[model samples]
Target chain A: MKELIEKYREIGFKLTPQRLAILRFLKGNTSHPTAENIYRQIKEVYPTVSFATVYNTLQALVDRGEVTEVTIDSQKRHFDPYPKPHHHIICIECNKIGDVFKDYSDALKLPKNILKEFKPVRNHINFYGICRECQKIGGIKYGNMSKSRAGCREF
Target chain B: MKELIEKYREIGFKLTPQRLAILRFLKGNTSHPTAENIYRQIKEVYPTVSFATVYNTLQALVDRGEVTEVTIDSQKRHFDPYPKPHHHIICIECNKIGDVFKDYSDALKLPKNILKEFKPVRNHINFYGICRECQKIGGIKYGNMSKSRAGCREF
Candidate 1:
C-alpha cells in the first residue's frame, strides 16, 4: 500500500488526505463501487472530504491507467481498481458484480465490415446472471430447484 | 406508424400525446437516444412533455421489450428500437454508435465457475472504435493515426 502511495507521488499525484483515503479504499476493492458509493464510504473516516475531491482522485487514477470504470448499472458509474484485463458478471437480481479473470479475445473477432470501417480497440462483455441469494429466494418462493432452474433460460 | 401504435396498444400501453410523439420519433430510430435526449427532442414539439412522461414511456417500452436500453454510454442510458439481436461499437472520439449484426456467443462463452454459480441468461458486447467523422477529426487534430487512437484511450 505504501508502494502505491510512492507510485502516485512519482506520477505527480498530490497526496491529499482525501485522495489517500480514496486510494486506500480502492487499492484492492472488487465491489466495483460508484463514485457516490466511494464518497459515502470515504466520508465515514474523513468527514470533510468533498464529492469533487473524490471525483478528482478517481479521474487521476483513471488517467494513470490504475483503475477502470464499470458501466454495467444504468443508474451510475462504478469504478474498478484492478488494471488487469478481465470481464464482469452482474447479477440481474441483486446488481452485485463479480469479476471473471479470463481473456476472451480469441472469440471476439470483429466482422469484416467493422474492420474495414473503424479499427476496433477493445471489447467488453456484460453477462447477466442470477446469484446465490436470488437462487435461494427462488427455492423459497417457487418451492423447487427444478422449476426455478427451468425459469432460467439456459442450463 | 399506425401499426406501431396498434402493436403497443395491444400490449396495453397508454398512448398519451407525449408517449405517441415519443413512439413516433422512436419507431424507426437507430441513433439510440437516452431518456434525457428523448425529453429534449420531445420538448421541442410538445412543450408540456415532462421528464416523468419521458421516463414513464421509456420504462414502459423497456418493460414491453419494444426498446432496448443500451448502457454503452457510461453517463446515461441509450435506447435502441431495433428489436433485432445485435451489438454496438461506439466511437470513443465522437460517441457515434454502429451496429454489428453478427453474434459472438461462441467467443463469449462464460467460464465453468461463472456458469455454475449463476444461471446465465443473456449477454451484450460493447466494442470501442473511432468513427469516420472522428477519424477525420483525428487526422486534422493529431496528424498521426497512433496519436489519434491515443485520444480514444483518454476515457
Candidate 2:
C-alpha cells in the first residue's frame, strides 16, 4: 500500500482522502467492483464523498495505467487493479467474475482473413458459465443467463 | 425474407407489424446496431413506435433465438440476426463492428485448472483496433482507446 501511494504521488496523482480510500479499495481488489460499488464503499468512510470524485479518481487511475477497466459486464464498467493481460470468466447466473490467468496468446491466432481487415491490437476472451453457489441455489434457469451472455446467441 | 417470416411464424413468434419491421431491419444486418439505432430507423417509417416496443421485440427475438445481442459495446447492446457461431472485430474509434467468420473453437482449450471449476459453455473474443477510416482521420489519441482495451495498460 505504501508503494502504491508513493508511486501515484510521484506520477502526480493527487492523493485526496477519498481517492486514497478508492485506491486502497482497488489496490488488490479482485471482486471487479463497479464505480458505484467503489463509491458506496468509499462513502461509508467519507459520508460527503461525491460520485464525481470516485469516477474522476477511476478515470485518472485508468489514464495512468494504475487500474484496468473490465468490460465483460455491459450494464456498468468493472475495475481491476492488476495491469497484466489476462482473461475473465463470468457466472451466467449471478454475474460473478473470476480471473483466468492462462495465457492463450499462442492459441488465439486470428484467421488470415480477419488479420487482413483489422490490424488486431489485442484480444480479450470472455468465458461464460455457471458459478458454484448459483449452481447449488438452482438459479441456473435455461433462459435466464445474464444479459452479457445474451450476445452469444449462436450457442 | 418470406422464409424468415414463415420460419418465425412456424415457431409461434407473433408477427406484429413493428416486430416484422424490426425483423426486416435485422434479417441480414451486419452493422451491429443498438436498440436505439434500430428504434430510430423504425421510427423513420413508423413514427409512433415506442422504445418499449423495440426493447420488447428484441427481448422476444432473443428468447426465440432469432436475434443475438452483441455485448462488446459497454454503453449499449448491439444486435446480430445471423445466429451462427462467429466472432466480432470492433473499431476502437468509431465503434464500427465487423463480422469474423473464422471458427476458433478447437484452439480455445482452457487450462486444466480453469476447466475444473466452471463448466465452460461458450466463448466470444473481442478484437479491438483502429479502422481504416479512423486511421485516415488520424483519431488514435494516446488515451482514446476504448474502455475494453483499457485493460491492456501497456498500450
Candidate 3:
C-alpha cells in the first residue's frame, strides 16, 4: 500500500482522506463497479462523501491509468483497476461483468481497408451471455426493454 | 417498407405515426446514433416528439430484435438498426464509431471454464484507433488517460 501511495504522490494526486478511502476501496476490487456503486460503498464509511468527489477522484484515477473503464454496460460506466490488459464478459440478463484475462491481440487484425482510414490502437471484446444464475431464473426481460408497452407484448 | 411494417405488426407492434417515423429513420441508418441524436432528428419532422416517445420506440425496437444497442460508448446508448451481426471501430480522438462488417465468431471460442459457467450468446469487438481526421490534426486527447502526469505522458 505504501508503494501505491508513493506512486500517486509522485503523480501529484492530492490524496485527500476521501481519495484515500476511494483508493482503498478500488485497490483490488474486481466487481467492475460503477460510479454510483463506488459512491454507495464509500458512503457507508464516509457518510458525508459527495458524488462529485467520487466522480472527480474516479476520473483522476482513470486519467492516470489506475482504473480502466469497462464499456460493457451502456447504462453506466464501470471502473476496473488497471492491473494488466484484459477484456470483459457481461451477463445479458443480470448485467454482471466477468473478467477475461487471455490476450487475443494476435487474432484481432483489422481489415486492410479500415486500417487505411484509422491507425488501430487497442481493442476490447464484449462477450454477451446468460450467466448461470440468470439462466436458472429464466430472466428474459433484457433490461434495455423500452418502458412503454403501449401495444407491444411479444417480449 | 411495407414488408417492414408487416414484420413488426405481425409481432404485435402498434404502428403509430411517431413510431413509424422513428422506424423509417432507423431503417438503414449506419451512423450508430444515440437516443438524443435520434430524438433531435425526429423532432425536426415531428415537432411534438418527446424523449419518452423516442426512448420507448427504441426500447420496443431493441426488445423485438429490430435494433441492436451499441455498447461502445459509456456515456449514452447508441442504436444500430439491426442490419446483421457485425463489429465496430471507434476513433479514439474524435469518438467517431465506424462499422466493421466482417465476422470473427469462428475464432472467438471461450476458454472451457468460462463456457461452463455462462452460455455465450454473442460477441462484439470495439477497435480503438486514430481516425484519418484526428491524425491530420495531430490527434486530440485519447480521452482515457488517467489524470496523472507523473510517469505516464506517452498516450
Highest DockQ scorer: 3
Clash pairs (backbone) in predicted model 2? A151-B69
Q: Against the native chain B, what TM-score does each candidate's chain B reach?
A: 0.81, 0.84, 0.87
State the lDDT of candidate 3 residue by residue for B86-144, as single tens digits.
Answer: 89988766677778888888778888878877789999999998777677767346455
Q: What is the DockQ for all candidates, taken in turn?
A: 0.64, 0.61, 0.66
lDDT (C-alpha) at residue A67 in model 1: 91
Chain B global fold similarity (TM-score) for predicted model 1 against the true chain B: 0.81
Cα displacement (Å) at residue B48, model 1: 2.9
Please write out the lDDT profile of model 3 over residues A1-155, one tens digit for every residue. 88878989999998788998899998877777788988998999999999999999989988888888888767678888757888888776666667787788888888888998889999999998877766776745644432332222211
The C-alpha local distance difference test score for the whole of candidate 3 amounts to: 0.80
Q: What is the alpha-carbon interface RMSD for each candidate?
A: 1.3, 1.5, 1.1
Model 2 regions lying over 4 Å from their true place: A137-155, B137-155
Q: Is candidate 1 or candidate 2 better by lDDT?
A: 1
TM-score preference between candidates 1 and 3, better one: 3
lDDT of 2 by residue, A1-155 (tens): 79878998999987888888888888666677788888899999999999999889889988887787787765778888877778888777757677888777677777777676667777888888766655666643655454443323211
Residue-by-residue lDDT tens digits, candidate 1, A80-150: 98878788887676566778888887788888898777878888888888877678777343323322443
How well does each candidate superpose onto the true structure, as a TM-score?
0.84, 0.86, 0.88
